[model samples]
Target: MSHGPFQAQPTTKAALENVAGQLRQVLGLEKVDFFPVVKVLEFGLPSIFENFVFRVKEGPAMGDQHGLTFPDDSEIWLRDDVYEGVTQGKGRDRFTAAHEIGHLLLHSQRFLSRRMGDQPIRTNCDPEWQANCFGGCLLMPAILVKTCKYIDEVMDRFGVSRDAARHRTKQLNLSMQEVF
Candidate 1:
C-alpha cells in the first residue's frame, strides 16, 4: 500500500530546540536575547533562500489570516492589520511572522520533496500546530523560559503575548502562582 502525499514529520521538542539553537548561533543571540525580527527576516532568511527571492508583502484585509508563507517563491505575505501590529510592537504579529518562518523552515523541504513525486500532497500532521510550536520555541527558547520566574517575565523578555507566554509556561510545566 502506497501512502498518499508524503506527510511531513511532526517536529519534536528536540528538533525545535536544535533549530532555535542554530538560529541563535547564526544571529549571535544569547539566552535572554530578544529576537531582532527585521534582522532575522532580512539577513537570516537570505541564507536559507539560496537563489529564491524572499519578500514580505503587505496586503489588504486577510480576515483571520495574519500571515502566510509561500515556499514556492520564498515569500511571506502579511495582512495589513498584522503589519500594523508589528509596527506597534504587538507580540501576536511577531509570533505570526515567526510562525510563517517556521513553515518555511520546517515544511518547505517536505513540500518540495512531495511535489517531486506523483503523490497527491497531503499533511498527516497539522502544519499549523507544528508551526505554532516552532514559533513558541523560536521566540521563547527553553533556555530563557526555564529561568523565568513568571509568565509576565517571559512575555517581557521575549516580547510575546500573555497567551503565548502562558502556553509556553504550561508546556514547560512551570507554575503560575505569582499574582503578577
Candidate 2:
C-alpha cells in the first residue's frame, strides 16, 4: 500500500488470504466476531508465533512507521502512538499491527528472495501488497464481512476503519447492499 517488499515474494493474494484464514484458525479466532489484534500483538506473537513485540518510543528508529517487523531478529516494533491507539481500539492502528504480523509471517528467512532493482514490480511479489492483503483478510475476513448487511455493521463488528471495511466488502462483493 505505502512501501516495502524490498524483495520479491513467491505468493499470491489468494495464497495470502488462505494464510490469513489458516492463521485465524490456528489462533482460535476463526469464530471470533472481533479479533483482539492488540492481544495477539502483545501475547500471542511471543507464545504462538515466538516473535517479540515491542512498543517503541517515537524517534529516528521508526520514523513515520506505525509498525515494523524484523524477521531476522524475530521482533516487531510498533510506534508508541500506534500502540496507544491500538489499546483504545483504533482500527487503523490495529491494521498496522496486523500488517507487521503479516511481514513477520510471510517475509521471514524461509520465504525472502532479494530482487534486483531492474526487475519489474509485480503485485503478487510485492511484500507491501501481500501484507496489506493479509491484514485486510485477517481483520475483515470475507466470511465475516459476508454476514454483515451494511458497511457500518462491518466496521463495527470487525473493529475496522470505515475505509478498510468498505474495501473488504467491495472486494468480496457479497451480493448484499453496502449502505454507508
Candidate 3:
C-alpha cells in the first residue's frame, strides 16, 4: 500500500479517495462518470472491454497523457477518432478516464510541489503505475482485490480487460503470480 522512499503514505485506497476529493475541488468534477471522457473522444463500444490500455508503443505504454493540473485550463483530451481506433466499450473507456485522472492527481503534484534542497524533481515515477493504482482502487476497492481468486474473475465482475485486471491486482498489492 505504501510507496515512496519513506513509506510515509497511507494505503492506496485511502490515497485514491483523497485524490477523488481533490479532483472534485480542482476540476469541479462531481462524480466518477467513467463515460464523459470517452464520450468526449466519441469512441463507440466494442464487444471486448478491457478496463485498461495496452500500448504497442515501446517503453511503458499505459494510462493517459499527462501535464494537466488543478488550476491549469488544460483539458484532458481524447480525440474521437483516436478513441475509436484504440479501445473497445464503455468499461474500457471509463478505465482510461480513471487512469488519466490518476496521473492528474498523483503525478501532477511532483511537477507542482517544490522539493527540499531546491533540486528539480523528476518525472521518474511511472505514470502508468500511479494511474493503474488509482484505477484499481477506484474501480475495485482493496477488499475486492484481496478477496478475488483470479484476475479473470475480477475481469468478469468488473467488465474490464485481463490486462486491466492484472494491473489492478498488482496495484492493490494482490498476488498475480498464479493468474498472470
Minimal lDDT window, size 10, model 1:
1-10
Could you say which candidate leads in TM-score?
2
Greater-lDDT candidate between 2 and 3: 2
- Can you rank all candidates by TM-score, best first? 2, 1, 3
Per-residue C-alpha lDDT of model 3 across residues 118-139, encoded as one tens digit per residue: 4433433334455656765555
Model 2 / residue 41 / CA error / Å: 1.2
Q: What digit string (tens of lDDT, one per residue) describes model 2 on residues 41-89? A: 7777777755465566685677877788887777888888888888888
Error of 3 at 86 (Å): 9.3
Between 2 and 3, whose TM-score is larger? 2
Off by over 4 Å in 2: 1-5, 175-180
**What are the TM-scores, per candidate, against the unseen true structure?**
0.79, 0.89, 0.47
Q: How displaced is residue 81 in candidate 2, in Å? A: 0.6
Give the clashing residue pairs of candidate 3, or none. 41-80, 46-88, 50-161, 51-161
Q: Which stretches of candidate 3 lie over 4 Å from their true place?
A: 1-14, 17-71, 81-93, 106-128, 173-180
Per-residue CA lDDT of candidate 1, range 16-51, in tens? 768867777776775644777656776777875775
TM-score of 2: 0.89
Residue 109 error, candidate 2, Å? 3.0
